[model samples]
Target: MGIGDKRKSDAERQERRRQRLAVDGIKPMTVHFPDQDRSIVRDLSRRVLDGQSIRQVMRELGGSNQPDGNVVPPEVLAELDYVKARLVAIEREAASQLAEIEEAERQRRTLEAERDVARVAEAEERAKVHTTATEAQAATRAAQEAKERTTEALQRAEKAETAIRRARSLPGVRGRLVRWLAGDVLPD
Candidate 1:
């Protein structure tokens, strides 16, 4: 291809790569460094991806300059420090919130356990009350049966006493015979 066409093709390829990276949610680093220090910056980016703290990565990088003696700008270093502080603060806040959520969950579980115990106890008490009521009903029925039996016996005894009195009032041989058999003395 001609030189101009090659350049145009390379630009198009770079643009496509950038678009693909963006779509994949991989943000390109905005920090500019000397060409000779690109390897170090790439290493730092790798450490960040590996979940190292920003402060730790910065410490590892140290304040070393490029082989060409090109030091990072003072303003950029200051900005890095500021960003690291903000990240630390945000992490601390997240930890605090996580601790609070765990505490709330523990309390909720405890309350649920207590509520379950109360429900079980309430059911037990209801069972006891139902048993007591059943026993009372049974007792009432037994008492009624006993009273009915006693009343019937008393009625039979009264009828027997009336028959005995009527038999004693009869006057004749049969009455005399009945009195003798009943262990009553006969009248002269």
Candidate 2:
């Protein structure tokens, strides 16, 4: 095999070894450190090599198995529970009130929208009524003017009929009336 093929076979062999170790509760890891922390990495690696896992070293550094003077008392914990319950109740009440306010606002907006629609409808009705009233008034005026013209014409016709009767009663006017008005010669 070539050099590249040999290296690939070596990596596969190492991976199989890692899997076998993991099944026996032993896992391998790579640790990295900054150039300035080389000393720290060396110390950490030395502890791991001594059969102490990283977690054990970290637990010892974290002050485990030591008396803690800052332990919270049961009384304080109970009071904290009460305070938390009170805070939750306050938050729930505030949320309920907010929801109610939102509902009322929505209802108010709906009422306003309904009023706007009603106003538009009323305005349309008023326009229709006003137009009808104007048309009716115009028709009444036309009818009245026609009646007055007919009355005047009838009065003038009555006056002319009376004047004709008066002229015919005169002696010679009747004889001339047949010639001038009727265009006929007078018979004996």
Candidate 3:
């Protein structure tokens, strides 16, 4: 679709070619057998050139006996190992950060729970104080009412004593007459 895309496609194509070549156990250099003898070959790509024993070019065309030839190069293996190490480091760092976050969250929850407990305690204390104050107010009001009633009863007793004294000093009708007027003696 674009220039960058074309370059990407080209790079992908080359990578695929390299992988295919690796799978086929094709190497840049190989060893060849020339005239019933083995000889080292530098390039395996040339099919037309035939040199005897003097390091001829030959393709080993690998089999199960030479499994190392099917693997990637040592440099590629080293690079993959480096990438894996970096990824492992990143994962460990992420795990540490996650642990810190979880610890902080736990602390926050603990604080919230403590705060809730404190709030409940405060509310309970306030209610208790309010109830105590109400009880005290009721007791004070009852005491005031009792004092008023006692004063009224004392006044009535004083008035009854004054009436009895007045009736006693009156004349010879001291017993029944004083009692009847004071309502202490019932009239028949």
Best by TM-score: 1
Q: Compare candidates 2 and 3 on lDDT and give the better one.
A: 2
C-alpha RMSD (angstroms) for model 1: 14.0
Better of 1 and 3 by lDDT: 1
TM-score for model 1?
Answer: 0.52
Tens digits of per-residue lDDT for model 3 on 1-188? Answer: 99999999999998888787677665434445575333222233334233222122232432224345447878999999999999999999999999999999999999999999999999999999999999999999999999999999999988878767777667776755776676744222
C-alpha lDDT (0 to 100) for residue 161 of candidate 1: 65
Model 1: per-residue Cα lDDT over 79-150, one tens digit each = 999999999999999999999999999999999999999999999999999999999999999999999999
Give Cα-based local distance difference scores for all models.
0.83, 0.79, 0.73
Which segments of candidate 1 are over 4 A away from where they belong?
Answer: 1-72, 172-188
What lDDT is reached at residue 88 by model 2?
Answer: 100
Using lDDT as the measure, name the better of candidate 1 and candidate 2: 1
What is the alpha-carbon lDDT of model 1 when measured against the actual structure?
A: 0.83
Where model 3 places Cα greater than 4 Å from the true spot, the runs are 1-80, 174-188
Sort the candidates on TM-score, descending order: 1, 3, 2
lDDT of 2 by residue, 80-188 (tens): 9999999999999999999999999999999999999999999999999999999999999999999999999989877866665555556786746733663332223
Per-model TM-score, in order, reads 0.52, 0.50, 0.51
- In model 2, the worst 10-residue window by lDDT is 179-188
